[model samples]
Target chain A: MSPVPVLPAIPGPPLAVNLRSAQLVYGGLTLFDGLDLDLTGGCFTCLLGSSGIGKSSLLRLLAGLTAIGVSGDLRGDDGLPLTGRVAWMAQQDLLLPWLNVLDNVTLGSRLRGERPDRPRALNLLARVGLADAALARPDTLSGGMRQRAALARTLMEDRPVVLMDEPFSGLDALTRLRLQALAAELLIGRTVLLVTHDPLEALRLGGHILVMSGRPAIVQTLPDLPGAPPRDPGDPAVQAAYRAILRLLEVVT
Target chain B: MSAIRRGLATLAGVLLTWQMIIVIGELPPYILPNPWAVAASLGRNAGSLLSHASVTTLEILTGMVLGTMLGSGTALALGYSRRARRWLLPMLIASQAIPVFAIAPLLVLWLGYGMASKIAMTLLIIYFPVTANFYDGLRHVPPGWLDLARVMLPESRRWAVLRHIALPAALPALASGLRIAAAVAPIGAVLGEWVGSSAGLGYLMLHANSRMQVDLMFAALVTLATLAVGLYFAVDAALKRLLPWHPANPETTETG
Candidate 1:
């Protein structure tokens, strides 16, 4: 196939999320109760916590995903349900093994019984630095490349709200940094909730950093971000914020 | 050794061993004819044997096609509905309890001594494995993929989950069932022939045995084995081609 021009960048209109009085009670444990959270429209929110905390549950609650035991009044500021408007990305790429990269990226269209827009898919692949590998299978790609294809798939959805659960946590340090930068750049002007263990990643890419802590987890800090994401890690302010948040999430004795 | 050479050597050794056993035992022709006697019988009765071989081949191939279609259909039906699984599964297992060999005469009696009886036997023999394997595949689809399908796909096109995800995921398992079917399919057809038939290699073998034409009977048995082996490899090759994208890729021979 001939090279198709890249798809024009049209950012989705951002939707502000208000999850109010959220409570979750599982078997014998209460993860969180009477907690309020807000995802400011068109801003990146990074959620950092220890493993087994309610970070993922919170993200799932926002996504309206299956079997989330959380009870909350989750609504967009514009008075619309958040379910249909959300796109989800996960730690695993979740690309079907049988499909080539391009087809996987355009899967939403195929699943919806619409003819996939090939040019748009190709353009997204180009943006992800996988234009040449559009016809390549998922198993053939490296971990970073597979995740990039997934990022392209998420971008194709063009939903105003994107909920991601530790989407870059599995990558090597360098690859994770690169993907984090790439995600922040591509996800401009949308509501993005990212659950991650990396405080440095949160410092660099999060427009608003949130730290969830305690048994009945609560959002501790919605730290005031100095500027929009793709933040410079070399800055002293970022380094200082990283040190503080890193202490909260990890036990680095 | 390479695959072809290895296969050839195995064939030669088997024939050599058979000749050795006969020579050592000095058995009568009626007990076990020498390989040369069988070869001579094959050549002399080539035309009649060819007709009978062709009939048996037809029965095997026709049975395979119908069996595969019906087997896969049953598998789909079982996978498609919980109610079908609840009812059909036990009935299928109970059917297996009735030894197929014991029922061969009744099957011939009911369907008559024709191709219909033979085909039904083949279909019955293959149905369970196909349904069980394919249903297992469908049931064991990764929960993550279905979750994605639920989110990405619209609610109205729910069947698309089975089509795009579950069906493709289940193919390798289905292929396995088909392989077993192909290997065992000849037994059903031949069994039907042995019970009661006017044609096919089984009938010819029974006739030759009754007439004390031991060499002709041996020749017909050899022809049946060759047919079965050929059918197996053909199905194996086709199935391998059919599942290029499968996780195992079905091409592990070159690793050595």
Candidate 2:
């Protein structure tokens, strides 16, 4: 008998979102066809690809925001819907400019019929080092602060799975690194699917990176990072993985 | 260079032209009353004019409130429900097409010379714009915001979502509706009274015109004009007070 491959013990509930022969076509252009994925729980998987290679669409499919093709088949474990239970943060901050920081973070609670827990929201903000800016409105906040507030809001939903679509792509390097660390720390026990074009970001943050190609995506599962996350992206191992992802993206484009 | 200075300069020019015309022409006293003659008429009829003006003011005030409430209430109800929109929107548009002047006498016939006819006329005239504006505002909420609401919250809690997100977003349109209604409200009252009533600025003008008291007719016309301007400014002020972020709000935008 063959021995099973040993994996690290993951703390959260097991998640196995699998897609089989999933095809997406819009207006004669094929975004994806027969794409398949088996997302195992408790690992940060980054889907790396060039711009407009259906990376965002892939995340949307997993998040169940898009409909699966009628002729194609897609399935997930437990039949649990991701909407409201899986927090999806889009590329834009999407904060209500009229609402202050605390209100914005607690917005999920307001949406889900829960009384806004200001203290908990405040704590989350403080964890992100934004406690002092709680009362300020989103328009008054800087770009970095607004993104942090958006991240805090994404956490407020308390979802087990988080799908982030380039949440820190537009930020300056220092702010991006700071937020990347915060995300890694907060997402320790959760299942995270991050989509990014930057190979370095994928290497620094992802436990396992999936490189996708073609109109119909085919996944090339890359090696896992040896150590804990929030890794120094400049490390040799991380650089090697980054180069591999760059090659994958290059080939796909 | 400045808008206020330009406005003042224009006002000064108009007044000078008016005064010159009065001085140069040997015009009939009844045709175009001079500014001084009108002022003298106002002073002479101050006591009686004040009493009549009060009655007209009451009608204007009552009609304006009733019209605004009815218009806004219907707008909100129709806006919040698809059924209301499907049925009521077309009806509202058709109602606007039915001329208020054509209906004023009929309203007087039904409601008589009482304040009811005047308010009914005002409500009918001011309703279309307010309802249309409000419905469009509520309908035009950004798609992204709606997706955020559905993704972040439960279905049962959508009321709070609508209240917090949709209401404020719809406010600018509502303000615009209110401004138009304010301008239209007084005209409705005047038209209602013009058809059948013995009171209000409309009736006073009718009485003066019949008596060949052209100066007095001009005075009532002036009073009506002032009421319309005053009501419009009052709405503008209220809008600024409630929504300081509105683009037309002079204080906030100017200071920053």
Candidate 3:
């Protein structure tokens, strides 16, 4: 028999998520009602808010882990569920205590009943500089190392859209900066949406900042961020952009 | 100053008091044999008793293995499928309320005066805690972690998730169950032997007690206590080795 023809792998459709007339209610109060968000493909958007402005809730909606089921009133455009298209990294780096760094990094794929790919998992671990700690359990790792492992795991799903809810909030300044650079390098062209309280972090990584305030969010999209992200904040254009976002958030001294 | 030194001192004092009691009481030898008498009896009967003890140990080992396999398999079944959890979980709880003491005689009647009866008795007693502990571990994984699995992993990495996440998360609880089961397994075997068996440590104790061999009875009782402690330590050591990341390991205390 002749050699069988090998088919090229199918490419995923571009990420285009829309939240149309979405209403969220907790207890007697309404968090956001009639909220509409239109996100095009390959844009890094940050949702900036105060402590209780539902930034994490929005991320939960995208990830589909929230109490509200997908059958509820909220609908995502492009005929795909919000969760199916997006991968979310929560605030806490919830690595399993028993698994080492490499195993934890590959957990997402493993848990969803996928075949084990050790080399790819190792490569991702190496990317996060956790290749050396691959055999060490999560409890043996430092806080920063755990978070990096979580990041590598998040990247392993190969989802088109990535949603992160305050993934770097608890880290020290120096470590946070280093991770910011790592995230920028990792999330080059993926459709990224993140929730963060830190204006500096948002400005550093996000190409577009969406301020979520009031009952529903009133999004302000800012394009043309200078010198790209992972750039130093001391740059003049970056400083200007920071000031502009700070003014938009209305952080009065 | 040290806790171990204090503990040793306490134990020596207790032994001295026991010796004083034996000297003062002038008790009948058959009723209250002295520690020295019991020791002599143990030395004299060591060969026969050790063989009987070995039989009981084998029964405990067989029961422990079978019971753990059943318990873990049930826990895994209940964990992955909700329908099984709804039915089997309640049935497991109900089984615990029916005392093993009540069922040991029945097991002996059915399986005859043999190792099978002793193993069944141990399995009945040890199965509950293992299943409950492991099931709790499997079901109660953190929501954030499951989300991490869904988002980060592909179709292939799911089994690794169960091993790395489900197994470890449940381990502390499972260790607690196994420790309880280990002690109970020997007791269960002895109870079964007491009901029907002609050999084993339980039978030896019963025979010695009926014949007014007080020293021999004390020897058997001491052997049982030693067996329990040895089994406990063995299980503890195995758990520590299996899970080096577990908080029990002193070498990995830095993270905790």
Clashing residue pairs for model 1? none
lDDT of each: 0.85, 0.77, 0.78
Model 1 lDDT per residue over B1-256, tens place? 7888888999899889999988899988899998899999999989999999888888877877887787787778888878988988888787778878988899999999988888888777877777678878888888777867766753646588888888988888998888888898889889989999999999999999999999999999988999889988899889888777774644775533
lDDT of 2 by residue, A12-87 (tens): 5856566677677766777777777766665677888888777777777766564444234445476755555577
Candidate 3: global Cα-lDDT? 0.78
Each candidate's DockQ: 0.58, 0.42, 0.43
Q: Which CAPRI level is candidate 3?
A: acceptable
Recovered share of real interface contacts in candidate 3: 0.60
Q: Arrange candidates by lDDT, highest first: which order?
A: 1, 3, 2
Scored by DockQ, the top model is 1
Candidate 2, superposed: residue stretches over 4 Å from native: A1-16, A19-21, A66-79, A170-174, A251-253, B1-10, B23-26, B46-69, B72-80, B154-158, B245-256
The number of the candidate with the highest TM-score is 1
Residue-wise lDDT of candidate 3 within B1-256, one digit each (tens)? 6767887997789778877887789777887787789889999999878988998998999999999999988998888878998989889988999999998889999999989999998888899988988888788877766666554543335566676566767777788789889978897899999999988999999999999998999898888888888898899889878877766656754322
Query: Over the stretch B94-141, how does candidate 2's per-residue lDDT look in tens digits?
Result: 999999998898999999997789878887878887777877788887
Interface RMSD of each: 1.5, 2.3, 3.3
lDDT of 3 by residue, A69-157 (tens): 22133334457666555677878888777777777777655565667678877777878888789998888777788889888877876
- Candidate 1: where are CA atoms >4 Å away? A1-12, A23-27, A68-71, A250-253, B154-156, B247-256
